[model samples]
Target: MPARRQAPVTSHIWASGGRHLWPSGEASALQSHERGHLVYAASGVLAVHTERGTSIVPANRIAWTPARFAHHHRAHGDTDMRIVFLAPSLARLVPAHPTVFLATDLAREVLLALTGPRNSDYDQSARSRLSRVLVGELREAQEQPLQLPEPHDDRLQALAQLLYENPGDNTSLAEHGRHIGASARTLSRLFHDELGMTFYEWRTQLRIYHALVLLAEGRDATQTAFACGWANPSHFIAAFTAIIGTTPGRYRTN
Candidate 1:
């Protein structure tokens, strides 16, 4: 039998650019930095959480986060990704909010070059030139919206954890309330009070997050639908489209 290879950590750069991959449902730490970040999954799905909301980045899409934004990043499934750090001054050229951009070929190439090892030896002047080019490209890039609201209350946070742990579980509000030691009516109020959305809306977003991971791994829509708790493929497609403005087929394709 062939040897099973361990997942690679690849590289981590101190302040410029780096590339790495994360498997399904994997999450990074809540981190804040002085520099801004651009996170892209060249082939997979990524979900990033900031104070404002969660942004879902599909393949060929990049997520931009401004400086000093405390955020966490996650990958749904076998996500091939790149993370670029920009100086605070340069980041002002792009939008301050979390936005997704369509990664064109030239933009992709520049990103790749920056993260590649060949440019490591470049002098300060060369690095500055590359940074300027990247900022220019990002300024001209088209944006896509894939924002999902974050849960703020402890009760809602607990509920979200339960759903994440068991995506296949079809627990109702009453069941969840019982488990969490709250009444169904109380839970309903908490949803609005904390998450700014209803329980069903939050559940739909969670399911879509899981579906994005499976789709990125090249799973068929039907399989992904069943895996993420949808009764049927059509239902999954509809929900996914309603939230992401694109189908799983298009979301996965670069």
Candidate 2:
């Protein structure tokens, strides 16, 4: 007899069915499916990028991505990933794009159960009901704006990595350019070409993202502002409001 081919492990419409841990610099290729996806980081952080934006999902948070949206996912450092896929009909409650949110303990437990062995002989009605409930809870969950807009050039990419590593660095564009071996004008042009924003605007966006992370960790705005390289708290607040669509305090409350 001819050798039989094993079925592929990956499926389009299915539960998590397993817990996956990823090491630093690990990444998944760009993929799109008819079923929506929920990606949770159990221990460290995961970064997700879609056509809409880039989400920085830390532990205790989950990123919901709707069906048919091309995207890529990766772990920043050593991280744990729990992924669940929902059928198209069940996923309609969520927007047709990516949204990040805080995952409740109950939801977390249910997500964990998804990775367990399946009961092949049992009726699947109970499983379907549970999955429906999870989908509902996930849809009504608060939407968080913890995303950073990505720049589209090598220079800005390098600068972004530096800013992310040290949010407190208060270097001017000229100074940063010197460190990155580029002239101020060249850097500015690169920022405009890649990010569609000025160098200062891009820096402000980075600071705001850092501020959100700090604030989520229970830091006050004033402290976060200084920590994110803003000379004045007021300036930080203004920039945060401009890009984030609300005051820092209001944004954090959700």
Candidate 3:
């Protein structure tokens, strides 16, 4: 709603297997709909952002966003995305929060079949059975650590916002604490107590989230490393691989 002016709109399209079969959105677009739906990429990468955190979705990973949750999707490279709406009952079967699942072969096939226009050829019973299988596959899907949880503390929130806006700022915790009216130790405790991670860990997670977006935009990994506050490209690579399970160079589209 409200014209969604700030970010590029996610064009609803799915291009799979070297064939662009339907309409699709462009890169870095943000949009949402009311109904609960599952988003899968047939090619390239997708990043889903919500209040909970951000999830990086490669082609083999499926992303789910529940109904009425205001989420934004960004495409990395020339991505082909598929959106399938779920009935209210079926939607309840999945987690209410945004989730990422490892797409199994069966799950992927059922998904493509369900989203494709040829599904019109299938009867209701056949369609219903397929839906059930898809949901079952989703239920067993392995979750990924693609999220950067949000903090509730006002001071922590301020610090997070600052880093989010300027990922390249390599400010020490003591320096930030002085500005935020807390000691470095105090904030470090909050990060662990509330967000379950150290200050540096959370910041690295946030930076990687940003790095995914930049890499999705076809930005070079070296450039993305510096842009996202990583002073050393090699170090950034190590951290990124540890979290994302792949190198940033491979994450980008040529």
TM-score against truth, every candidate: 0.73, 0.60, 0.76
What order do you get sorting by lDDT, best first? Answer: 1, 3, 2
Model 1 clash pairs are: 24-76
Task: Give the alpha carbon lDDT tens digit for every residue of 204-250 in model 3.
Answer: 88788778667766689899999988889999999988877778877
* Residue 88, candidate 2: alpha-carbon lDDT: 69
Instruction: Give the Cα error of residue 42 in candidate 3, in Å.
Output: 3.5
Query: What lDDT score goes with residue 59 in model 3?
Result: 61
Lowest lDDT 10-mer window, candidate 3?
Answer: 15-24
lDDT: the better of candidates 1 and 3: 1
lDDT string for model 1 (15-115, tens) is 58787767655667678878888888766677888888788887666789988889887776777678888887889889988787877667777777777
Candidate 3 Cα misplacement greater than 4 A, ranges = 1-35, 43-45, 68-79
Question: lDDT at 211 for candidate 3?
Answer: 80
TM-score of 2: 0.60
Mark the regions of model 2 whose C-alpha exceeds 4 Å error after superposition.
1-18, 116-123, 151-168, 172-254
Tens digit of per-residue lDDT, candidate 2, span 1-254: 01122222222224433456766456677788777888876655677778766787765567888888888776655566778777667877777668887677677766656643452332567667666777777766788757667765677778877887887788888999888888899998887776677877666766765675577556888988889988888988888777665677775554
Point out where model 1 deviates above 4 Å: 1-8, 12-15, 21-30, 49-54, 95-109, 116-150, 168-175, 178-189
lDDT (CA) per prediction? 0.76, 0.70, 0.75
Clashing residue pairs in candidate 3 are 8-29, 11-24, 11-25, 13-23, 13-24
